[model samples]
Target: MTVKPADRDFDALFADPSTRARAARGVSIRLSGLTRRFGELEVLRGIDLDIAAGRFVAIVGRSGCGKSTLLRLLSGLDRPSGGELAFGAGEDDDVVPRLMFQEPRLLPWARVVDNVAVGLGRDRDAPDGRLRVASALAAVGLAEKAEAWPAVLSGGQKQRVALARALVSRPRFLALDEPLGALDALTRIGMQSLLERVWLAQGFTAVLVTHDVGEAIALADRVVMIEEGRVALDVAVDLPRPRRRGSAEAARLEAEILRHLVHEEPPDVGWVI
Candidate 1:
C-alpha cells in the first residue's frame, strides 16, 4: 500500500524514541577503538570519542586527517572499518541523518523549488511536499527564487538552495562536510550567518567539519580539534550570539586551537617547574 501523502511528518522522525536518543540530552556519539584503512594506508586510527546531543560542534584538522570520513560515518553515508558506530536514537526508529556537502549539487535542469522537493521524496504533488518545499526556500531567503533555474542563481544562492534541500527533511542530526568551503570570503561569511539563523530556528544535532578556525568558533557551541586521526582538544565556547571574527574572545579561542593545530604544543612557554 502507498503511504498517505499526509502521513510523513519530517518532524515526527525526530519525535521517535530512537531518534530522540540520538539528539536529546545525555546522549553521545561513542566510537571505541575505531579504525579505517584503504588498501595499506590507515585514514582513521583507533578512535574513541563521544559528542553530546543538541550541541553544535566543529571538527578541524589539516588535509588527510579523516575529518570528512568521521562526519560521513556519523551520517551513515559510510560505515566504520573496525569500531562500533551506534547512535542513541532508539531500537525502533532509524537515525534521521542528513549530509550537506561543499558543493551545492543542485540539478541544473530542475527549478530551484523542485530541487528542494527532491528531499521530500518522489511525489511533488502532495500538500505537505509543497508546504515543506516552500517553507524551506523561505527559510533560506529564496522563496522568490523558487521558479528560477540553477544556472540563473549566484554561487551563494545555489549553496543556499542545497541547504534548503537538506533542511526540508527535518533531519535529527546534520553532518556538514565543509559546506561553505567553495565560496568566496564575503559570501562565506554571509553563509555562516545564514546557517546560524537556520540552526537557531530549528535546533538539530549538528556536527560540522571545517578548515576555517574562525568559522568554526563563530558557529559551533563546541570545537574539537583532530590530529593523527584522533581528537586532540575539545573546547566549549561560552559566548553570545552573532559571534564576530577578530573579537577579543574569538581571537583568544582561535589562538588556543591554532597552538595545538599548527605548532603541536600548548601555551606552556610561561609554565614554571
Candidate 2:
C-alpha cells in the first residue's frame, strides 16, 4: 500500500515518544471588568470572566448581545476598551490564540496542505512544517484531501480544512465564532462532535460563541448567557461527554436557556449548576 504524505506525517508525529507530551497545555484566561465600545455603542460592559485551563465554555445569547465581541477580545483580535485581559502563566508567551469563524476563509489557489501550512506563519518553511500540517489534516479526518484545492471540497470539508489550519500550530486558546452555523443541520451536528473530540484530544481552552442553545448544552463544560452587553447567566453543563442530543436533560437545559433569552432575565430554576 502506498503511504500518502499525510499518512507518513501522521505516523511521524506519533513515532516520536515526545510527541505525546508535546501537546500544548491550555491557557487560563482572566477578564477583569472587560469593556468594548464602538464610538458610543457599548458592546461589552464591565464583563468579568475567568476560564480555567482546558475548559470548554460556550457563550450563547440573542443577536447583538456582544458575544462575538467578547470572543474577539479573548482571541486577541480586538482590544478591550477598558480593564484587563490576561492569560495564565507557565505557557510560551509566543503562542498566539487561534480563531475560527463561520466562513472557512481558505485560499482558493492553495492546496489543502498549503492552506493549513498558513497557520505556521513565519515557520512555514521549517523542516517539519509539512509534518505538522499533515498531522493536523489527519486529526480532522481530511488526510486524503491534502492535495485537493479548497474550491473542490464540500462546505463541511472546507470547514475541516480551516479547523486543521487552526490546529496545526497547537494554539493554547481557540475562539470559535459560530463556526458550524453555516452548515446544514446534519453536517452541523457532525462538526460539533468533531469539535468536541479534537478539543478533548488537544486540551485547548475553547470559547465558542453560538446561538444554538442545544449546541451549547451538548458541547460546553459550561454555558454562559450574555444579555444586554452583560453576562446574565453562567451555568455549568455538568453532563457527561458524547451527550445524547435529544435526551430529556438536554431538552430541559435547552428550554431553560431559551427562556432566559426570550425573557431577558435569568431563569430562577437553579439552572446554574
Candidate 3:
C-alpha cells in the first residue's frame, strides 16, 4: 500500500483517543425519486442515490448535466421539486452541510483569521471561536498566515482559507463544487492531497462535483456520472488508497469513464469497475 501525505498527518492527529472521539462522523445521504425544476427546465429528472457515511463520492458529467444541481440539493442550497431527500443514521437537524466553491470567496477586508471565523456564524464571538478558527487554519497548514490578508495569499492559499472556513464549522457533510478547479495543475494536485487528509481526519461525508473523470477516480470511493439529468453510470473504485494518477488501473478507469462522457461506443466498455 502506498502511503499518502494524509496518512502521516492522520496518524499524528488522531493518536489521542479523546481527540479522535471528538471528530465528526459522516452523515449518510439518501435521495429517492428526487426531481428539480426551474420553470420549464428540469435539471434533475429523478435521482436515486444512497451515499454511505464517511464515503467520498464524486459526481461527474458534461456541462449542464445537473452535476452541480445535484450537489446543491445535497448541500441543502436548493430543494427538490419532487421526491424525497433525507440524511440518515448518526445525523440530526443540527448537522449543517458545508459547501466549498470554485472561487475562494473570502472577504477582502477581513484578515485570514476573521475570514475563517465567519464560518461560525452567530458563534464567532463565542469564547472558543478564536481557538476553533486557529485550529481550522492549522489543519489546512495555514497557521502562519492567520494574521495575513486574503489579498496577500496565493490562489492555492486562498482556497486553503476557504477550506478552513468550511471545516471550522465541523460539518458532517461537505459538498465540493469544483473547489480546486481554479488552481494551477501542481497546486490542484497538492490541494487534492490536503483535502483527502482533512476528510480522513474529520471523517466527513464528501460529495465532489467535477468535470474531470481522472480526478473523480483518484479521490472518490465511487464515481457517479450524470447524464440527461439521471445517473447513467455508477462505479466503485476498488483500487488501494493513495491512488496513483498515472498508474495502469487509474488510466483504465479514466478511459472507461471518458467513453461514457463522450458517448463513445467502445465494444468492450462496461461499468463493472
Candidate 4:
C-alpha cells in the first residue's frame, strides 16, 4: 500500500517493531478552558477534557448544544476563542486530522477511487497514489466499486466510499459528525460495525458526535454529554466490544445517558455521580 504523504511519520512508526509499540499508545488530547463564540453567542464555554490516545470517545447532545462546534475546533477546522488544545507524545504535535460529515460529500464527476484520493490533496498525483487509494477502498469493502461513479452507488456504498476517503489520509485523529445518520436502520448497524473494526485495526483516536445515545454507548470507550455549551456529564462505558444491543447492561447505560439529555436538570443530582 502507498503511504499517505501526510501520514508517513505515523505509518513509519507502525512499520518498525520498536516504534509499533509506541504507536499503539494513541495520542493524548488535552483541552483547557476551551471556548468558542459567534458575536454575542457562546457555543463552547470554558470546557476542559482529556482523551487518552487510541481511545474512542463519543460526544452526544441535543441540537444546538455546541457539540458540533467543539468538534470543529478539535479538528482544527475552527479556531477556539480561548483555551489550550494540545496533542501529546508525537514528533509532530499537530497531525492533520480527518473529518467526516453526515453527507458522503463525494464529487459526482469523480470516480469512487478518485473521490477517495481527494483526501490525499496534492499527493493524489504522487506515484503511489493509486496503491493508497486501492488499499483504502479495500479496507472499506468498496474495492469492487472503486471504478464506479458515485451516483451509481447506493447510499451505504457512498458512505463507505466516504469512509475510505476519510481513512485514505491515514489520519491519527478521526472526527465523525453523524456520518451514518442518513442510512437506513440495517445499513446504519452495518456501518457501525465497519467503523468499530476499522478503529480497532488503526488504533486512531476517534471523536464522534452523534445524538443517538444507543450508538454512542455501543461504540465508545467513554461517552460525554454536552449540555448548554458545557460538559454536563462524562461517563465511562465499561461494556465489552461487539455488545449486544438489547442487553440489560446496554439498556441501563443508554438510560443513564438519556436521562441527562432528556431532563432540564439532572434528576436527583447527587445520585448521578
Cα lDDT of model 1 by residue, 122-157, tens digit:
445776888888878777778789999999998888
State TM-scores per candidate.
0.84, 0.87, 0.88, 0.87
Q: Which candidate has the highest TM-score of all?
A: 3
Which stretches of model 2 miss by more than 4 angstroms? 1-24, 90-92, 264-273
- lDDT of candidate 3 vs native? 0.83
- Candidate 1 off by > 4 Å: 1-28, 122-126, 264-273
The TM-score between candidate 1 and the true structure equals: 0.84
- Candidate 4 lDDT tens digits, 181-266: 88888888888877886776677889999978889988999999988899999999998875667789989999988876777755
Please write out the lDDT profile of model 3 over residues 1-273, one tens digit for every residue: 112345455445433334344233777888999999999999999999999877899999877889899999888888889999888663364668899988999999999999999988778778988888987887787888999999999999999999999988888889999998888888888888778767767778899999778788889999999998999999998888666668898899889988778765455644322
Q: Candidate 2 on 140-193: residue-level lDDT in tens?
A: 778889999998999999998999999888888899999988888888888888
lDDT of each: 0.77, 0.83, 0.83, 0.83
TM-score of 4: 0.87
